[model samples]
Target: MRNPKKRGAAGNSNRAHGSSAPGVASENTDGGYNAGMAVFSYIIGGIIVWSLIGWGLDFLWGTRWIVLAGALLGAVGGFYLSHMHGLTSSRKNTGDRPAAGGPSQDGGTNAK
Candidate 1:
């Protein structure tokens, strides 16, 4: 025979699984913030790499402005590329839901 207290505890645990549990909040902690960080890191990394390459080329060619120009262009391009890629990837990951007349896992229309 089970102890009365143990049986009560088990019953309470089962009740917790029901949908009406209080103090439950549904929210995603990981989302666009991570994507933004990834883009920033990519841009900074590209800028550093290009700057180094520019410095090396400048040293070899004895032209300082060439290195500066290359670094500037690389930084701008890297930022744009990273931003575009990050936006596209985020959308692809989250926006591929079915359209109208498609079956949804949640048994609801995909209209949004």
Candidate 2:
């Protein structure tokens, strides 16, 4: 007759033989920041920059249009900048997976 503990150990070894070591899994090395957030940050930064420029011009020139113009330009620029930033960073981080357009894995784009 064989010992039960010996049999259990043998069984355990067999289970682990053909498998990957525990906790060894494919991991993304990009710190997990997705494309949307990247774009959002870029847009926000652009807006701030443009807004400041506009505000400075308004202050110096005594014109509110300048500031308004700056805000408008900033909004447009922000959208584009953010979108591009998001796409580029996403691509770099996610490898070959598509980062924009045609239905994302996480649903649709949040662009406004």
Candidate 3:
């Protein structure tokens, strides 16, 4: 004789696939976190490396302002590197090309 007091399914409902804890996201990142982390690491790493180089130069050349210059240069170079890697939003949303030739950023189409 089967029990009639059960209200729902017998298995655990809170458990998720590929994970044991609850409230975990199942969507695939597709390397989204990798790109973001790369951007962050590039900026911070550039600054640290340039500052060290500048410190060495200052020690050799006997100047106190080279470190500041190196930090500034690092910031600029980091931004440039990020742009070169195409990690910025300028190249995003490339898969949604409208079939009707939608308007561009300038509020107009490129078609003649």
Better of 1 and 3 by TM-score: 3
List candidate 2 segments past 4 Å from native: 1-33, 85-112
| TM-score for predicted model 3 compared with the true structure | 0.55
| Candidate closer to the true structure by TM-score (higher is better), 1 or 2 | 1
What C-alpha lDDT do the candidate models reach, one value each?
0.66, 0.64, 0.72
**TM-score of model 1 (CA atoms):** 0.47
Total clashing pairs in model 2: 0
lDDT of 3 by residue, 1-112 (tens): 5566764465545555565455333544344665677678788888888999999999999999999889888877887798788765544454677344745676556656
| Model 1, span 7-110: residue lDDT tens | 56556664445335443322433446655766677767777888888899899989888667767877787778876765435434356664557466776666
Model 2 clash pairs? none
Cα lDDT, model 1, residue 71: 71
Give the lDDT of residue 40 in candidate 1: 74
Please state the error at residue 22 of candidate 3 in Å.
26
Model 3 misplaced regions, further than 4 Å? 1-30, 94-112
Ranking by lDDT: 3, 1, 2
